[model samples]
Target chain A: MIAVMSGSFLQRGEPAIMDKFHRTKAALSSGVDIVLELPYIYAVQNSDLFAQGAVQTLHEIGVSSLCFGSESGDISRFTSSYNVLQQEQPAYQTVLQKNLNLGLSFPEASRHAYQQIGLATSEMDLTKPNNILGFSYVKAILDHNLSIKPLTITRIKSAYHDQAITGSIASATSIRKDLLSKGHISETAVDALPDVTIQQLHTYKKQAGIWHSWEDYFQLIHYRVMTMTKEELAAIHGVDEGLENRIKKTARSATSFYEWINKIKTKRYTWTRLQRIFAHILTSTAKADLQPFINAKTVPYVRLLGMTKTGQSYLNDRKKDMDVPLISTLAGTKNPLLSIEEKASHAYYSIIPGEKKQTLHHQELKPPIII
Target chain B: MIAVMSGSFLQRGEPAIMDKFHRTKAALSSGVDIVLELPYIYAVQNSDLFAQGAVQTLHEIGVSSLCFGSESGDISRFTSSYNVLQQEQPAYQTVLQKNLNLGLSFPEASRHAYQQIGLATSEMDLTKPNNILGFSYVKAILDHNLSIKPLTITRIKSAYHDQAITGSIASATSIRKDLLSKGHISETAVDALPDVTIQQLHTYKKQAGIWHSWEDYFQLIHYRVMTMTKEELAAIHGVDEGLENRIKKTARSATSFYEWINKIKTKRYTWTRLQRIFAHILTSTAKADLQPFINAKTVPYVRLLGMTKTGQSYLNDRKKDMDVPLISTLAGTKNPLLSIEEKASHAYYSIIPGEKKQTLHHQELKPPIII
Candidate 1:
């Protein structure tokens, strides 16, 4: 199943929310063999974007068998909305905007359009945003002519927005919220979480690293857009000609990243579409420069973050065939910026209270913890 | 005469000797009004190389004259050496190497080559390296069919290698030795120096802004070479195609920068030549890349380190048809790098130290003292 997941948005042009390499490693370690990197723009923008990037990467990768969790577990009802998005496609643009113009929030407008179309609203709980994202992923996979089959995982209580850690497996959202609020691995998350997840969180907190979120890159994003020449801005990953000048001029008046996006976003663009443009603009991410990288996915070297002897051997056996070199220690090298990202991740990981690393401002006391 | 002078050589693959922008400013501020930035590779290496860059830049810029200082005040002597270099140069190739193989120093080897040519022993005085450089510049201007003429300023008392400052304006060698000895500008230099010069040097020192020479970037240079693929290394600044693998093999064995150059030097290639190759590799300098710049002579950047109001007004009048932009202030702009460079130059100017600047480091410090 090509399970579409929202990759963490890296705003502020810092490192990703979790270590990107670390996150990829996490998914790889979890037996989820192929984790697609969701462009940060799609992750930060509203639901429409979640669909666009998730669907596009999936389409490009030729992924099939799309899967997601749904509040409405029943098979027939969910299909009705899915079918409406696929087959009986009324003008989604007109319907969605008409609802929004009537003072509905974007999510409400989407739901209202679904209900008015005689889609089986009774059987589908289109209220939660995550489910809507799940729905969009399904509809987009179908629309793109990809041969992906959709699968559903039924919900087991603890609402999508729930911050409480009730069971052994806590929601990622709650875990992240709790981790940030407590400023280290929370005892609740550490205690309730499965063993593998705990080690990942603990290693990242207190000593080795910090996390960056899209919410923080507001200034950097705004400034980058404002400064770039229109021609240069047009080269941004998602930006097109003429739109760049609009973005550049609008960027100056933007109060924040979101404000800039709002000013630049247009009828042809969804917020997610616009967010991707902003992300690219902020990072100077020219598609011409980076497209080759998209096709050429493997990094030249695999840096060892943390590994058991078994993991080490697993890597050693595979290293011979691997196209890239693997780097473990930086005892002799001259790269200065390399270690800083890991150190920051460790700082963020430490925020969950009562973990081995409970310290704040992690950079001050970073000494690599040797296994 | 419009004498063309090449600044420090930036040998590719090697660590940078001096920052080009800073050196250019220092030269210009020290009455070098029409500064030429001979690509770093050419400037750092020995005489033949110094000529290649300086001559090329002069030819391209359409400059008519070249001024180089010589201990042997007779300019014709340098011209004769120039003529000798362009001839079927045999004694220079072998005799020079024979001296080097005998463990003789740079001066001894240089003298050996000249003496073999039946030149007067005193005429071949190799202690004055600048004279050799001047000789090469003249040779190259003629060889390249460039319009530029060559001129010489007689050496003023202080010999190029003299450990002691024998005059008001000591040779850069003595100045550096004195700085190293005391870790600050010397009292002798302070009293003898022009006021404007002292002001900038003090600014640099106070700012804790390191005046990083070739030494500081040694690690960066090493890491850059080590990290690159064979093809990438070959494509680097100075590396020729086959030279890529040779460098890669050497990189695996060489421990230090000098060691690498020594390992690579051959009968055909001198240490200075190797140094330039290294510089090219590190800085991503290539003959093709540099050739265009050399042909362009100088970019139309006035790049004022510090200018009087009269200079500004004169520029204002001159700028109407000026091809380049007249940048006065960075103005919270993206071009802060250029401003940072200007501020950095404040450290190299050596007179009226306190008046020049109290510091020239972090953004917290004051900007360069605008004249």
Candidate 2:
């Protein structure tokens, strides 16, 4: 199976505990044929947009079945709920607006909207993180009219965001939380991850090389938020509609990233949404930089991270039919979006522990991994 | 006497050992009538521009005599040398061009130019730090034709930038170096400073509030230097003549400010000049913001950092004759220049140790000292 993964940063808008190379190695040893990077922007984005980017990329690469772990293990329920939301679009939007006006979070408002449109079900819980992403992927497939089929595998063990392990397959969220708190992988967490991944985590911990959280970037973010005018902050991609004023005001006294999040979190904006916005702010990502890609339905390139020999042969055979450039090396690349990803990667390296920091990680310096 | 001092960041282009409030208190207890701030732009600038700003502000505020510490302690020699360089401009220019062509630094070339034009004297040592500033102050007096007499006091005990303690009077540089290296003020260094200054230093050290150097800001600087293109860096003041290209190239490999300095230093730019340039870059000071004041040959305002009772009366008596606004408080101050100072102060607090950090030092929160 091909794996599309976040590189240096992850969906929680923090640096990955392990660097991309180690993560790719983990995937390779775990029997994945290929590993492609989900660009930083998409990787740190909210569930809906992130799903769209991943689904679109996978479809373009001629992947027929898109399978993901979901709590319900029922793909038909997700598709059915997505179809109902699509059929009653105006009614669903009206209810969503009502919920939002009452200061419910986006996910909360979305769930309320689904219920109002008679689309909520026991097997299709949109509030669950995996289910939310699963629904988004199926919706993107239908919206784009692609020929890709959707599938689901049952997620066993701890819930998506739970920090406590419940079974043999602990959630990735729990594993990361444990690793950060204890600074090493526990035996329980080791059981949840592949041996290759466990080994990498252990090595990074020994060297104090594991990245903790967005806390490492809190100082720069505080400086930016404290210094920028409301108008200047309003120019960032996710900042909008008086949110800049709130953030600017709260930033003066908030000493840490967690404090800023707590101070600025309103019922309308969820914790995850604020984290994503801060990721953009930390990188200084402007709205203009993301506009072209947002307007386009297809990703500009399939950036190869790592692949096995079988995967390489398959790519070579399908190279002639590829719709977009398959970028293996960054030399002479003309795409502006990819250039932003390169800049984001450099930003990622800037926060790693000093001894382990490879401060200059230009795209040209990294060759595609082959195993 | 009125003391025009640098604020949070100093002429050496790093955070002050203590905040402005305590520094003002130290100045007041040591017999200074008033302590006014040299706004951030001029405060962190090179000697020539810094002297110009201080002299112009003092002249506008009806100060009659400009007295400063100099190695030579001879005002007439400074005046005579400045006059000869001004009167024989073309001859000095030719010699200056020749020295520059021979790959000498600007200050060195200017000194050589003065000597070539028969302006050198044993009592007019322009190569010394205080002497250079002393000469600039006198030249500014002549250039503006202000009604102000120039006087000099001999700098005793320790030479500027000398880290070794030669006598009871330690240089400010030596005190700062010792404090950073040991994390406390030594009794020998204490003997060199006023009791009030010693108290402040001890308090800051007790709380771990001592700022080391540009090293504290090197990470943010590295991020900016790495991510910014040469064109983007070119917009900063003092970045010119393809220096951006060299800096951009050197930044890719240099992990620290000192490392970058070693790689990028050339014959034309001395280490101090480069430190000042990096100070400007760190604050994002653009050429456009400095052009108006440079072209006008006057500072925008005189900000009152602290004052004693006699100093207050002196300011009151000269209020009608003041050419620029003397700002006692920043609330409702419309000057763009003061805003920059405020931002620079916030940047200073960002690097201080967290527990001792006063992150929200607003203008309204800090009233002028009454001693």
For all predictions, the C-alpha RMSD in Å is: 10.5, 2.9
lDDT agreement with native, every candidate: 0.51, 0.78
Model 1's alpha-carbon lDDT is 0.51
lDDT for B340 (candidate 2): 76
Off by over 4 Å in 2: A98-104, A329-334, A353-355, A359-364, B91-104, B123-128, B156-158, B161-163, B227-231, B330-334, B359-364
lDDT of 2 by residue, A1-371 (tens): 88889876788777777677777878888899888888877788878778878987897678989998888898889888877887899998999999888888888998888877776667677778888888878888898889989999987766888887655778777877777777666777777777888876666555445454777777777765655556658988789868998898787777778888999998887788888788777666778778877747888888888899999998888778888888877666767877677667666677654435653254335777888
> How high is the lDDT of residue B232 in model 1?
50
lDDT of 2 at B108: 89
TM-scores of the candidates, chain A only: 0.58, 0.94
Give each model a TM-score: 0.55, 0.92
The prediction achieving the highest TM-score against the true structure is 2
Ignoring the other chain, what TM-score does chain B have in each prediction? 0.61, 0.93
Steric collisions counted per model: 64, 0
